[model samples]
Target: MPMNRIQFQPGLSMPEFFEQYGSESRCEAALERARWPEGFRCPCCGTWAHCVLRGANRKMFQCNACRHQTWLIAGTIFQGTKLGLTIWFLAIYLISQAKTGLSALALKRHLGVSYPTAWLIHHKLMHAMAAREERYVLSGQVQVDDAYLGGERGGGKAGRGSENKVPFVAAVSLSDEGHPLRVKLSPVPGFTLKAIAVWASTNLAVGSTVCSDGLACFSAVTEAGCVHQPTVVAGRKPKE
Candidate 1:
């Protein structure tokens, strides 16, 4: 038997995050290093030699060869932002480093920002995350379950037709021993064959086996080049 070389590491806490990215200048330098590791090259023209101009707020990078000017946060998510770099870093830490994740209202209170600002930041960050997730494919044996999220609307309809039920599919990839490896919870318009096919195409890997309850729409995974195994629940039940 061999030990798994993969190791799980914990995320940075608030104190640790502050120690590393505590000030705006530190955040700016870190972002610059991450974006242009070799050196600052002019976006307009490919030149390495550049000078820094201290503006009212941000520092502009001027290429000596091409005379093109650019800022540290230009062309990035932080572009044309009134918020400070430290605040943006804090928001990223809270949204990503948290174990259970944080809500927009909670982020608003934690960052001391207004509701609209917190909501906007959270929305953009989450949208970016989902866009990134679209590039990944779930491999190996996958267990999939159909589900509906959201609570019932007060004094409104109930059951599947309830106004509050947002249909979704929860799929989890399993290791060789049947342990859950990774999970994907995606919202779909409905549990129809078309929706399931679309979800399978986007999320599941080709030739992977999908296990699910005996649902007709589960067959749609075959259209995505995956094998489907439907399970039947045998029990004594009386229809009321």
Candidate 2:
């Protein structure tokens, strides 16, 4: 079967955006609303503090019990980041909509932030994605396979021809009841028994029935207590 890829178009004009929220006070109000959607709750005392004005009559609130004064942009991803609110919104919009992943340089130009700052923010967002996705586990019937992702070889005599290739083993689990082999790929140093054993132990459960083409490294699977079914080819016939 053939596969299709997706492309995204640019989105939103600044004037169209500002026409919705054009002023400093308007922007601040929007930030306050987003940061405190449940109204003002005192961070110190955890009570719903009364909304009060800050310097120049700003829209910040003073904590009722502890009198701990704070703004809406406190203690979140936006906290302590000095980039303008408009740029922050644009940065978020661009990254969320991007499919091939955005470069720090791209984000810098798109959001008008320094290169170093953009890199920092981009890495921070990537960390956030991993943290969020780490909660889910792959379960049920799984597919075990090795994909050679070798790269140009390097280091000593081991870095010779076929160096451009690396070994990757993965186990993709069936979705719902259908077996689609949704494995997680990990780079194996080589097709060595030690490498395969470590990868299998980490990626497969003790009860999983793994299928392979009789690779020696996979012998450890049986030793590890899982049933291994090796597909066989003998002479002109097959052995069950």
Candidate 3:
């Protein structure tokens, strides 16, 4: 068996992360660059001319045209945060880079912060991630499948009808070269045509070509203005 390229790809090491964003100043600079790639533009007046005011805690940008003042972290997930940018950046790095996901308790220990602070940080980051994901709709050639979470308990029903199972729809968009792009895994109430139609309307863009197994419910994607291409599994395994 060969190693999976995606799983084995090189990633930023702890030392490398520290080298780039170890200091508060470095993290702040990085955030500024990310927020304004071209340069500072006042959010209120959209002017590039701004003056930096030295606050006791952080720098504030004042637009010369509109006299509007905004903090570096204003209107962002890091807004009004009392924590240092370095700490927040480190938390982001840890949460995003963790393979098995990082818990709030573990994050607290890592950042040497209070449990409540860590929990709040974790919640905010997760909410930000979810909000960003909600804006994305898959387009072009998309592959979709029905999935389930959990398994039957000792005394419960088995297989697809198991009481413990929660149904979900898994969709992956592919590029022109057939490379995978974005993926969406959304939970549905059940594998009914109505459920599939609702999920398709929310997740798929109009005119997207959706390929899925011969599940009758998937035909409902057509109701969402997407083209559904069904493939017969005929009891063969997915790999086959």
lDDT of all predictions: 0.86, 0.66, 0.91
lDDT of 1 by residue, 56-79 (tens): 699789999989889888877888
RMSD versus native structure for model 2 = 6.5
Q: Write the residue-wise lDDT of candidate 2 on 38-126 in tens digits.
A: 77788778988565866533346787788888866666666676666666666666787676889999998877778999998888777
Q: Model 3's lDDT to the true fold?
A: 0.91
Better of 1 and 2 by lDDT: 1
CA lDDT of 143 in candidate 2? 60
Report RMSD (Å) for each prediction in the order shown. Answer: 5.3, 6.5, 2.8
Q: Whose lDDT is higher: candidate 1's or candidate 3's?
A: 3
Clashes of 3: 0
Backbone collision tally, model 2:
11
- What lDDT score is found at residue 167 in candidate 2? 69
Candidate 3 residues 80-188, lDDT tens each?
A: 8888999999999999999899999999999999999999999999899999999999999999998999944788777665779998899999999998999999999
Give the distance in Å from residue 26's predicted Cα in candidate 1 to where it truly belongs. Answer: 2.1
**Candidate closer to the true structure by lDDT (higher is better), 2 or 3:** 3
Show the colliding residue pairs in model 3: none
